[model samples]
Target: MTARGYPKSYALRRGVILRAAVHTTMLASEPALGGFLAWDGTDYVLNNADGTYAAITFDGSDIVGVFFDAESSYNPYVSGGAYDIEIFFRGMPPRLRSLAERHALAYNRQNYQCRSMALITAAFWSVDDYLTAAFPWEDVFRHGAHIVRVELLGDTDEAWQEWREAYQCSPGQLAAARALFWRDLSK
Candidate 1:
């Protein structure tokens, strides 16, 4: 059973795990669900699982946010080095915006910056195409931020090199290439 208390769905694709962030009031209201875990004030993890759980935090009224960590021991597949991925958003919804605000506050308070930065190059082909894309750059980047830094927790040097070559971006050229890619995709 997944942490949401539902049987793990075969339909659910697994790659990177995600979690929710909630406010104290919400935690107080739903002790059974929220009490099972503790809030580090930055991110939440499963208390009982062998480091394999992801959670989201919510405000008293609604789900406010979600995030992930690099050091989670549950999935060893996450690389020690940076993994190149892109998150694009069509637009930020109210719920997502609230979550983002909380995530930023927590990240700043913890001083949890990515030691290594990962490059994401995304383009929107079609709405459906964007939805079908493995990593939804359109949806993830909807805040209008030109660039974002991501941490890679599950990739290897060889794999990173291969991806870089395929994308044709050196570390220096990554930002420009990503911008161009996104621009071309928008059309």
Candidate 2:
């Protein structure tokens, strides 16, 4: 069972289905779903261990969002490291998540684009919920923000944050981490 009391099999099935959907969406070659680095006629593709990829979406030259593809995400800190893998399976560290987020914010800021960042993922991975809920979702949806309001997350950011925080043993998230890190992963 998951921390939310979902059966492990159910979660795994949902993950597989969601991954297929994401792959299909990417293959459709929709301009809105194109990789962020498309300006140079190339993409900043983040490859996963399973040979799948997560690409950033852009509106014109401004990056708007990214989907967390199945499998562990590649370490963006390592240049020319698309194949590099995260140590943990099924999810990534929250700190790394934060780092990538900061980099994205900086990138957008430097480029004078919207500072908004969307983390779109099917919340089937072990720590996906914990990571995605760390930030508040924007209520007023931007041009490319529609996909961020996917199924797993709650209708409102506050509601999602409450669920995730309680599940992660929060009040003090770091303290909870020290006491209960990966404790419910077997669920």
Best by lDDT: 2
Model 1 regions more than 4 Å off? 1-36, 39-45, 65-91, 103-187
lDDT of 2 at 81: 47
Clashes of each: 29, 1
Provide the lowest-lDDT 10-residue window in model 1: 10-19
Tell me each candidate's TM-score: 0.26, 0.24
* Model 2: number of backbone collisions: 1
Per-candidate RMSD vs. true structure?
Answer: 20.0, 18.2
Q: What RMSD does model 1 have?
A: 20.0
- 54-115 in candidate 1: lDDT tens per residue? 33333322322223333332112344443332232234454545564454324322211434
Cα lDDT tens digits for candidate 2, 47-142: 333423333322222222243432323223223343312222124345544443543322322111233433333221223322222222221122
